[model samples]
Target: MKQREFLKKEKEDIRILMKFAGIYCRENHSGEKVPFAFKLFDIKKIERKEIALCSECTRLLTYGLTMRLKCPHDPKPMCKKCETQCYHSAYKAKIREVMKFSGMYLIKHGRVDMLYHYFK
Candidate 1:
């Protein structure tokens, strides 16, 4: 994939994961709600949508985004299938929880189209 397309996919994946994390956070966290802008990689006008998430979710989202941006795979493989795992143990567990929970949430809610990345 070209750089542009890769970045676009990464941005969309981050947005999806963050949305899941936000849903999980809204149910669990009690801190103040905050806005997080997806403005990494100097893409300028792209991926600027702001998500309202708790501080802990925001940190997880940021960490996930950073890993996505720095990821070495082209036509990147899923994290589970990758040879190297970039996330710390705790973060890895947290992300798995978020992905699994949100994936089921989406599937149960009939958001089946959203499962392609999560399941495959």
Candidate 2:
């Protein structure tokens, strides 16, 4: 893929990852949330610059984003459909939990547009 397309994909994936982590953290965890410092790459274009997540959720989000950035696929396949399993088993399970909870919450809360991606 071209650089533009790759960057677009990165931004979208980052947004989704952050949103899922934020929702899951807020709903399931309790603690003082701190702003996550992005150390892998510059995310200036990502709108949510100050995502405050619990330590556990922040670690999960950081792992997810790292996997996304290092993905080997040219046109990245969704992790669910990909043949190569990049995430560790623990993180994979945690992300699945996050996706399930947040996806359902979004749909019930009138984020109808998320339905396609949720089912896709």
Tell me the lDDT of candidate 1: 0.74
Candidate of highest TM-score: 2
Q: Local error of candidate 2 at 87, Å?
A: 0.5
CA lDDT, every model vs. true structure: 0.74, 0.80
Angstrom error at residue 95, model 2: 0.4
Which residue ranges in model 1 land beyond 4 Å of their true spot? 1-6, 42-49
Tens-digit lDDT string for candidate 1 (1-120): 224544667766766776787777776678798877555544324445556788788888878877877889888888888988888999999999988888788888898887776566
Task: Give candidate 1's root-mean-square deviation (CA, Å).
Answer: 3.4
Candidate 2 per-residue lDDT over residues 1-120, each given as its tens digit: 223333776777787788778888889989799987777565545844567899999899989988888899978887788999999999999999998999988988998685464355
Q: How many residue pairs clash in each candidate?
A: 0, 0
TM-scores for every predicted model: 0.80, 0.86
Range of the 10 consecutive residues with the lowest summed lDDT in candidate 2? 1-10
